[model samples]
Target: MKRKVFLSTTFKSLLFLLFSFIYTLLPLQAQQLYQPAEQLGELFEQVQLQSVFPDSKTFPDATPLASPDEILQAYQQQKDQPGFDLRTFVMNNFEMPPQPAADFRSDTSLTVIQHIEQLWPVLTRQPGNDAGSLIPLPNAYVVPGGRFREIYYWDSFFTMLGLQASGETELIQNMVDNFTHLINTTGHIPNGNRTYYLSRSQPPFYALMLRVLAQQKGKEILTNYAPALKKEYDFWMEGANTLNAANPAHRRVVRLPDGSILNRYWDDKPEPRPESYLEDVHLAQESGRNPEELYRHIRAAAESGWDFSSRWFSDANSLGTIHTTDIIPVDLNALLFHTEMTLAQMAEMQGNKAEAKRYEQRAKERQKALLKYAWNEADDFFYDYDFVKGTTTNIPTLAAVFPLYFCMAKRKHASAVAQKIEADFLKPGGVVTTLNRTGQQWDSPNGWAPLQWMTIQALRNYKHTRLADTIARNWTRRNIEVYQATGKLVEKYNVEDLTLEAGGGEYPNQDGFGWTNGVLLKLLTLHPELLQTTEQEAVLQR
Candidate 1:
């Protein structure tokens, strides 16, 4: 009896080993199935639509607790059963996404800068195994906090400013490597390191980040990152050669009537964004425009990193009229100009004269085209070119300062923009994002740290030292005031009215703000006098 039992057990063990070996030999996708969005198709959409979680992003960000195949199989079997609970099924199959910085309480006794230093560790995320929608990075990175639990493309550049001030050189290099890794493995960096964000990217700030790294390490840092930089530039200019008058635009590339090429924000997908699924669906229903066209425009605006702003809207007050892809943004072109010039320098360093010359020519052509098309001679500011209408956009936002930031603005243009800033845009706290009060976070009344830094730096570039100083003083003072009041730095501030918190956006204003911490620390470093102000004085300034 004992021998028969042993033989039966041995036979079962042998079969198990055989099956495991066969499983290993199967195709990778067959063996390990599912990207979160594709795997949980109906479940994903329904969860978002029903508002299973208050934030639409929650379900998409949740991690699978079991093998995707097992989860999917179970879901299919149980979904149509009587008394099926979608929420319970989801909870059983997946781990809910954690609230960002949930239990942390700020120690108000510390100075704001000291508090920022402490918060760095809290905001920093160590890379782990990839699961669900979250794409894994090889190195640890600082997230922008709140719902932004990933390293954002453009946000990282500004965040690095604080990291630099904090003397976190290794951390900065780690971030740059992570971005380069994304370029190497994924072909281009997504808006953030997520499968859902693969369809689009935020503003191209890779070249700017390289410049910062080079400043910290050495000029050779640019040479090392040259290939990744070229890859990014190529990603933006993908269909430039294919574009002609007959097909004026293809993806991000646009060919003007003069046969000059410029870039615009674009998305590969025309569907509602996976994260903001319900919001896009509802907006499209009310938009009256073709759903696909509206979806594309909405996604493109997201790609621009200004999700909903008057700058992208046909009617400043209406979110439904956003037409982002129709306009060639000044800031986007200016950043690309910098990328081209940087590539030229990197090529020259490596003795690739032909590539160097090619990049130089591209940069010059872009500069000329930018001045011709995007520059508003009457307003003396750079505006986005509405290619669909064959005219410059009437909306004048902080993007006008980008030309000056890149040293592409003429002396007259720079002076005019500085005057415009002081006369119209500058506020008690900082410069407002744009002149229009459209109840969009990127519009009037709300000031963001990155824009404040850009405007101040742009003015300083033009030797408008007094204006720069005044702006810096106001901005730093406001930051200090907010910190004293709330014991937390926020994503955006109410620059126009100091008493109220920054408002207007899909979500409430978020704290643990990566860019705010970064820009504030850098500003304080530059203007140490702002640190010495008494609490009463900080309050009185408001």
Candidate 2:
């Protein structure tokens, strides 16, 4: 009797062990089976909707989507909501489709499709109007909250291009109008159309903004916006020549000769940078420099958006010549030159030919100095020259391309530089902002919409149609692939893996992104014809 009872107890223990193993394996298998289907279903849902509200905290009282029916019901309810507040509803509930579960290692096509589909919603959203306002349409992508609550300065420029392509001209006009309004209401445009950017401004794009509006709306639009444009121009040139003067405490200060003024990528105070926390730390380590020096370097780099340490600065002797301090950037000067030229053109249009001629002469002089000082023949690229140290950084970066945009670089140099971009910067997805091994957000492995547009435009300007077509086709193909797969558009993509990574900025990459959508559409519409031999010949003649 005792032996039989002991055997029975052992049998029960074995049974219990077997059940536990099965329990663990069941969920893992179930997850594998369920997740992909769920994610695909989500993508289908997104394809059918116009916008979604992903920010729930902003609308805590709204109902949650318990099922597909609930999502549709919410839309109907939103349509009925008073005051045309579709934006509020969409911001509270939008979510991106899950990344495809296929092995990224074996299937490049699957990876490309996944990325494009993920970017779909971002591509479809209307262009103008505040991204976070009470507008009544669903944005095509998901944008994160916190520091991303407002529209960014430079980002808007690219976003506008996408809008133009999507046949959303009215929305683009609205976006331009908002910026003009901000300039009229405030002495300067905010860094973004948000409360956060109110403290400091980014690169002065007011002239560029006006130019874009004029291109879309007609030359006459400039007359109405001239006062606001002048005000913004003055804001950028403020204290430009006042290196020796005492200034208001709140005003940005920079040393002369170097032409360094407080520019973009800085805040009023020394709070940690929200987007580039890792890059900033690495820069400090590689430079073997102090925080104050690094801070100034950060500011200088902000002028060009190429914030990283490279082989150029690896040597201490060369690094010393690098103005990590109050430094001026060649691109900044080039941009200002364009601004001046635009002003001269505007003056000419308004019948102020005498003033136009004066401004034109000033632009030409600046251009001459820019080429003389910024171009490094040894490196075969234009670099940021530190006027104080009287040396140029030898790091080859995207800033080198801007000279071509402004006709600052001669034809020979532009051709050489364009070749460098094709060889080094071009990736499968698009031209990267910079090389990625540097670990900078703006560097390699990261492709941003604005830089892509800039590179395309610059290549066309220099008559490199073959190269331009290659870039435009690659970018558009990638964009469409992602859109078809995920049913949304995104702010940035991971060029290294050819997958979508969270975009960098003060916040998580916001989808329903105004600029990304706008620029993609623009590229789709204009890029195909941009590569004709006639276009290339025209550039050469110019």
Candidate 3:
């Protein structure tokens, strides 16, 4: 009996050793299943409690879930009037610019310009205030200071506008070349030149970038970048065509019910998301809320940007907001439609009829799906339809205007939405981001440069020239007014008050802004004719 016991003990020890060796040899991805300790620990406790007392009858009551149809009905009823008090919204949300000067003055005089030119190398320094992070090689320089602002995705789009207007065709081409080079090297474009954004991309602007470059340069440029464009497209559509499906994770492309595929924003690990944490803390401090609740609020905001959005927030979970889990988005799909159209055009030009036909068909199908699922006829706007909840947020925001820009919205529907904008969101200053009373930067009383430009362009596309012109002019006037008063361009503005207090973002109202300044120059130069288009005739006809 003593010998048998000894043998069993020795076998157990050997097994343990084998397991330890196997664990050590595991891949990094398998070994690093690191979830947030707090969240995971809570989940573990719940599992243990259920296992320990199988007969225990403890369940939380179900909260009522709002359907997209219900939200749309409610929004249709309430969207006509000003959704929130304009004055209070502006005052509560606005943040004044920091006191003291950063000295970014432009010198036009020959002597000063010459001196400034000599110092351009130092002045246009890339974001290297910290020695810890690697500085990216400089691309095109933002003039006046020659400072290297890595105009990421949106900044690049807006900067291209200025480059086009200022007759800097070479610079515009260089910007496109940089993006193409990055795509070829990395398989995807980073949000900026920052190492932090290397993991996830911003908007899929590769096709748009190519289209713009092609327009500016010619077919030769498009031909050169076609392979790069195709590679980036493959990156966005990664994991989408997999037959052996697995649980979705960051960077995985998922398909929606409508059969279109797109990627949603995600991070591999969960921490208190820096962007939402800052915004939520600011909001909680302003509203006098408990810090814990603010954390939850921030988590909710972060989850909203995730692939499985409904799973991220309690309020959103019931509506099958889960449909967005690895699902396509209206904006994303619309952008893809543009991509398909561009690709088809390129293929046709290249004498590839087979490829052109395939892309053209794909674009049409996506357009159909986007309109079918995302549009709410009753509300006269587009809201993200949660396929799971059969619900939509009836929130009239700038996202609604994207379809128009893509020429995806029907002429009649686009016209109706434009009228709704005039009746509701548009102010003397420009267009508000959304009608939500939350006072978020993406909410009302805050007007962003990109959204304003988008709205103006969308209206012009629909031949609503007059209203488009008015919006463009009003936005430019407000921008010029603020600049003349403060000698600075801001990231956003208090549209309601024409005040310097710009509100609602992770950072405290970023200035020395790149995109805002770029868009302003573009609108003023390329589309001045849009400002002169009259809406008086359309109103009279109505």
Candidate 4:
């Protein structure tokens, strides 16, 4: 027994020295752990909670049975028991439900609006340490579907669009404040509330959320959110001060051939994502390329929120050929362009003319860069540029709608983009994410709520009223039909085939979809004339 104690003490000392060495040598931006804890006690503690306890019961039934305080106490007090099994201890002592009480509503008779209202109560949560979450929002916040119980970055923008139209302005403000808190605490918001998501963010939608508020409230609200939004803009422009022609790109900032700056999807960590653990690990093993390159591509795709999509892959059909870091996405830059414009307007509202002018200039530069690189003259559409290959990508996607959505495109450009979308992109259900048929959820055959909102509004803004109405009617019908059939609004729909359900992702399709509810409500409010008829809801054709 004494010999075992001596060995444990020596091992702990070695781990302490290793941990100190890593902290000193590699100070990552997010302070993410490079490797798991090495000390046996720490390692054992992690395995018990993160691995043993988590993977023990599977999700739905997997919400932690103890409060964070209680769990921590149990871990501290009895973690050193001989042949310790924390899983058994938790099971015996806790009263966790078998499954998350099958979402509160099952009545197909409820109107889509009624269904959304029901979800508001079902999805709202107070600050707590639920199984997979650690959100710190002061007021209740809505979450997306299964396994996504935390407030997500980009998803909230579209979700708030519906919230605003529903007369729930305070909830929207509360969510925005939660994001503000995250930005202030973490320097930038992580992908979600989890500690593991700190190394990256999804599309920069902080400014857009403020835009939604300003439209409902006056531009004066911008003054309150201006600093937080600027902090967000600065997060995207972190390495811009040092960028020169020779350097060209560093972190999120990318310099085009014309000496103008735009942003790209990027993640500081060159490693697998914690949420999609097994999927990433399997990808790493199968990828013949350098593991670092593969990890960066995976991380970059997460930043785009179109993980495993053909849009970022060198071979559109092959996930193994993904090269996300080398591409500057059209939608991503357009969103940032809006951010720049919003910051300028907010500064003007605050009577800061100089700051406003600076941001206005930045917006102009980004607009010019998009027209120069993303526009395809012959195709009359925007495509993501392959920065490494020095050419525009061949894929045609709904992302082209953004230039019109932001009013950044010329009338001629909007005309061409609208014509292309009408001819190829629009389908029986709605506009697909892309024309490519790659079996990723973000590719053909799958239509998501946020993209549907963006495309419909962009078309209407460009005066393609007929096309916009057609797309909106079809898309909303899908939402209503699926709700009528399954009594649930889901994450994606079958836009291409139109007969089967949407598929292709790391997990099965999910319901209680926050953005879907948001976009559907906003559309119904915008064009109340285009209501679905129960008398004879026409069958969607393939």
Best-performing candidate as measured by lDDT:
1
Misplaced by over 4 Å in model 2 are: 1-147, 244-325, 496-510, 528-542
- Off-target runs (Cα >4 Å) in candidate 4 are 1-103, 128-135, 532-542
Ordered from best to worst TM-score, the candidate numbers read 1, 4, 3, 2
lDDT of 3 by residue, 18-94 (tens): 44344436442342222222222332233223332221111110011233234234434543576543223212322
Candidate 3: C-alpha RMSD to true structure equals 19.6
Encode model 1's per-residue lDDT on 105-217: one tens digit a residue.
98887888899998889999898755677777767899999998888999999999999888887678778878877776567889998788988999999999988877877
TM-score, every prediction: 0.92, 0.63, 0.66, 0.84
Q: Write the per-residue lDDT of candidate 2 for residues 1-542, one digit (tens) a residue.
A: 01111223234324533443344354322322211112324332332232233332122112233343465466666665668555554445543222222222223233322333344343333434322222111122222212244445666666655544444444455555556555645466665543323445666666776667567557766655556667776776565565543441123434434343322233343422322333344556676867555655454444333434342243422333234333445656777788778878878889999978987887887777777777888867787665445567665667777778777778988988898898988887778765535444555567777767777888889899888778776666665555545644566666656565635432354344445555666765564443243234434756
Candidate 2 vs 4: which has more lDDT? 4
Per-candidate local distance difference test? 0.86, 0.53, 0.54, 0.75
Q: Candidate 4 residues 129-224, lDDT tens each?
A: 433334354456778866566778999998898788777766776687678767766678788776567778998889888778667666666777
Segments in model 3 whose C-alpha atoms lie over 4 Å from true places: 1-101, 106-138, 141-149, 243-252, 258-263, 272-328, 527-542
Question: Candidate 3 or 4, higher TM-score?
Answer: 4
After TM-score superposition, what is the CA distance of residue 419 in candidate 4 from its true location, in Å? 1.3
How much does candidate 2 score in TM-score? Answer: 0.63
Greater-lDDT candidate between 3 and 4: 4
The TM-score that candidate 1 achieves is: 0.92
